[model samples]
Target: MTDQPQVSAEKPSEASADQAAPTPEAEAIAAYLLKHPEFFVEHEELLTTLRIPHQRGDTVSLVERQLKLLRDRNIEMRHRLSQLMDVARDNDRLFDKTRRLMLALIDASSLEEVVIAVEDSLRQEFQVPFVSLILFSEKPLPVGRWVSTEDAQKAIGGLISDEKIVCGVLREHELAFLYGAEQGEHVGSSAVVALTHQGLHGVLAIGSRDPQYYKSSVGTLFLSYIAEVLGRVLPRFTQSSRPVY
Candidate 1:
């Protein structure tokens, strides 16, 4: 009957107390609110009371935040619309110039005249600084900048592929051959359109002084269309049984 050991009840550790405390179920509450968005509509008062941190280190009501987001999206949409309008105006001007050039080519009677028309239109109308025409034929056309097939292959053999248009900065040798020593030195960018039609093959090269004037990613639809017109019409002037040197 003796001395029984007195048992003392120990207090829980700090870690155990923290773990046992009832924590706010923030994630669960958020999920519930997302699932039932109508809950906000029913409790309209919460919209005015709910505070959201703004990008500028200030708190705003949920309704104010929503308005700010809408305003930002509206501004972005207007900027995009303005860019689209600018592009449309540029396309319209280009189309008009292309039409005039095509008409001029159609009116020309000889290969030399066609060459003059092209150079004049591109320089005076299209504002291109430099232009060159290279024909791949046994006999050369009586035109300035017209190079023989052998000469073209020797200078830019790799560049002359099927009938695709090439645009961007050109190599030093290519620039020299296309624009000559003095002018080529100043040319920073160029576009070369391949010509292939009715046993004829050639290239139409255009150059500009600005390095960024022609880029690899620039559209070549108009250049290709102009080349096609040249191809079809050039044969008409060079259909002689004997070569026109």
Candidate 2:
């Protein structure tokens, strides 16, 4: 099972509760990923292993440079971000019963607003007990008073300090489904995106408390959509509208 950062008020699942604590492979893989999350995008060799399509890779290459692939509306780019935006919009409309909730999710005018909106929408969409939205920067956030799970934070913090992982996962799976029950060895699973400040993209962490949650075998197209949306929104918020004197 993956050791996803479980934040929020939910509990871990029964099957997850029963499984033993992190195995060497699971721990190593998680740690390795945390350190080199860029491997998700940068390492060309691991692209196939991660199942990132070649066309998507090339598209990402162009997207990272902020080049709108308008070469052919008739012939879409290998990976179409417009398609992903359509998914996000549909997701927003589907889950939100009222219009205000939908507006709150997308009317984000700043990074903090974006984080809060994403935390709510994504946790609900992924059916997770807890979730968080993290903004990565060369500068660190003043040590926030809360640490979701002490142990998970410790492991992740270590990797971050050593530059092992790219960004932190904000929710825990173990607690999501296991609430009001027992303390299990297994914990939350996570859906991760590498939030690169340089690339103008941020990670979208969707976590679950179920043992059967996110697997290495699963695809992350939706999570990619989430990241892509944030990538577009954040800069607009930061760009000053006032004229430079």
Candidate 3:
């Protein structure tokens, strides 16, 4: 048979030399993810792409190492989130508990009850182990002295002693809070705040086991609140506690 004349066909235009070409490795990586985005993303893909045989122990070792690192980071993130959740829950409980107890403290019927309430509240609020409350009065007569401290009744029965600590308080409202002042028998580092209204006046003492618990420039909102409650409650106690003439 006679050979037919070859038909000439125009060649398609080629891309400019300056144009960049996508590498086969990049295309392979994209296809691997597109086919199995989740299951193939981790260490196993490293071996699969490299076409490492099952007999190659070195490839398996490297894959295990990378997987362990990812697992550790995931565990650390979960642990940190758990700790933050616990802290949020604890703070919520504390604010609610403190607000309730403080309200109960304000309703105390007597000075002793007030002190007990204050001590309990402080222990719960601030996490202190121990607490005490003292009231100082220049009532023209020593009040809350023998009555509060029965053991000191015999010693104080002799009117007044030169060694008594009352001299410092009535020395004037000069000292607001005494942290660790030497006060003979009543000797604990205490938060001494004043409470006064017209004719009836006194200082309130709040003490704890730790010496550093109370400081000089500490804000007195809670202390002042207790003092105000005491002013209201003391009147009722005084009328009921007065000796029959």
lDDT of each: 0.77, 0.46, 0.47
Q: Tell me the tens digit of each residue's lDDT in model 2 across 1-245.
A: 98999789879899999999988999999899899867655644343334222355434552332222233433574357778888788767654533443466478665566666666565565455545444433343332112222333333333223211222233344233222124322335555553333342233445455645666626455555555556556545543211111
RMSD of each: 12.1, 32.2, 14.0
Which candidate number would show the highest lDDT if scored against the true structure? 1
lDDT of 1: 0.77
Residue 159, model 2, lDDT: 24
What's the CA error at residue 70 for candidate 1, in Å?
A: 0.8
**Whole-model alpha-carbon lDDT for candidate 2:** 0.46
Best by TM-score: 1
Query: Lowest summed-lDDT stretch of 10 residues in model 2?
Result: 159-168
Report the lDDT tens digits of candidate 1 across residue range 24-88.
79768988889996786576545555666656546554667566666777899999999999999
Cα lDDT for residue 26, candidate 1: 72
Using lDDT, rank the candidates from best to worst.
1, 3, 2
Stretches > 4 Å off in candidate 1:
1-59, 240-245
